[model samples]
Target: MSKARDFILDIFMPTRCPCCEGFIKWDKLLCEECERALEPVDNSNEVPPAGCSAAVSAFKYDGAAKQGIYALKDGWGISFAVYTAPLLAEKLKGCGADLITCVPMAKRKANERGYNQAEVIAKELSKLMGIPYDGGLLTRRTTSMAQHDLETASERAEFAKTLYGIADGHSDITGKKLLLADDIHTTGATLSECAGRLLSMGASDIIAVTLCRTVKEK
Candidate 1:
């Protein structure tokens, strides 16, 4: 019944590939060409940010992956979350997370955007992975400059520290293992800052996951 409904809807409101904006099957997230262009991340070389026990990402922040992320952020392709969650869920198999959470967006920014992309992905992931999700695990302290605007890693890290705090009534996560979700991983600064807050609140461990990550130049 749902598939029939989706097919009917596709006739009028066809699902476009998030990366290329080309018409695609109602059930597909990316066109074939865009899917082929994705570069998977090498998890063996991934280094978790301080306070996080592990970090995993599905693809390099380039090509189709970059466009897909941008699409989600700009509110054009929310279905990106439905496509990405399963991949991250596979990576997180055996990661014993008691709760799933996400990097918080400032209230002002969330209001303007009408949704937090990170939270959207996290909730989808929680449903797919069978984990409890807590959207209120953290809160943004201020509306700071966007992380992409920071050029250097040091600058990004410093600015991120001032952005997040444990959400009210979530002070004691005692012994809970958490999985943190976000749309992208650049310098890992924002995830690190959030993980630190969770650790300080007594979380036993944190595993961070993202849809894509910037590949550092050697």
Candidate 2:
């Protein structure tokens, strides 16, 4: 039955580059150069007090990376999650954990989009990493104002105050490792805010993995 389902999907939905909209080779998700182009977030010497670790993105958010992210978020190219998950997995090599939690959306956005793109990436990453995925650990409240449009760090900090965590009474993660997943990382205000929430909840450790990271021009 599973094989039949895959066969049907293959025929009806051929995989393609989320950016270029061209066919992605059967076994390869992104082309070689695309894989090498991702920039890792700098956590080398500036580790957080918390045991949290992070893997860099495969591409800097520029040409192809920008297009791929925009395609998934705006173009409704949901299958892009499947193609990008393996790359996340490769960057995540040697990291093992008990639960995979995704960056959640505001309830309204999730309902309107019919899904959270981050949740989709987390599900695919779960399959690749052989870890169970949980969507309930963190929840986002109503939409905060756009962070990009803000002119000052104070404005960004004010927006960060809007993100809060809601726990669903599930398995306990105290002393257990967690892989926090997301689709992209901008100023990281969102991820940092979420991480702060998790630490407050007794989550012992965290490893953040995102499909892409925004590069600020110097």
Candidate 3:
């Protein structure tokens, strides 16, 4: 399908709010109420993932924020990135990031879904931040356990090492700060693995930025 034709078709179709199913503008993913209900994570202090120097999230993965990310990941088309990019870009001010990249989806899964929401979000953010968005910095070699499917975080940690493979031609990462973006951060296993892989390639630092993050339950 041509992107031009898809864009035209999307314009005629009514985009519904992910939560309420009410009509919304093509660029809007959530209605006013759903949008207002989300709370930004207090990213004032750098919350680094286990293997990375710093990390941040735009919203806590609860209520509307969770629903919005789900819609972006599964329910809607690529347009959801249009709505989510600004939410992350506005929060990234002053973070000295040299380049931008995103967690990679398996080739089969990405083909089945037709798009990777994380890469889309990252590219949109790159456009806003004026940083490079390299969709090929990392590739998913194996489809590992969904973090939520695991009984504990330890199990998630054990499976992380086999999940990703670094790409070639990325050796320029040596001593450069990198911003890794994703749609959500649950146990941080995925982000941690990707960050460590880049670090091994001589990247100096990694600042992971997720659009949503799951708050641990007591």
Clashing pairs in 3: none
Top-lDDT candidate index: 1
Considering TM-score, where higher is better, how would the candidates rank from best to worst? 1, 3, 2
The local lDDT score (0 to 100) that residue 118 gets in candidate 3 is: 83
TM-score for each prediction? Answer: 0.93, 0.78, 0.87
Give candidate 2's total backbone clashes.
3
Ranked candidates (lDDT, high to low): 1, 3, 2
Model 1 lDDT tens row, 119-142: 988998898889999887789965
Better of 2 and 3 by TM-score: 3
Supply the global lDDT for candidate 1: 0.87
Model 1, total clashes: 0
Q: In the order shown, what is each candidate's alpha-carbon RMSD? A: 1.8, 3.6, 2.9
Residue-level lDDT of model 2, residues 14-47, one tens digit each, is 6566666777654445565655554544434332
Top candidate by TM-score? 1
Poorly placed runs, candidate 2 (over 4 Å) = 1-16, 22-51, 168-170
Q: What digit string (tens of lDDT, one per residue) describes model 3 on residues 1-218?
A: 46666457658887687655678765556788877887767776545777777777877888877767777767374544566678778877878888898998887777767778888888888999999877778888746455567777779877777778888765477888888988888778888999989988888999888887776555
Q: What is the C-alpha local distance difference test score of candidate 3?
A: 0.77
Off by over 4 Å in 1: 1-5
Worst 10 residues of 3 by lDDT: 75-84
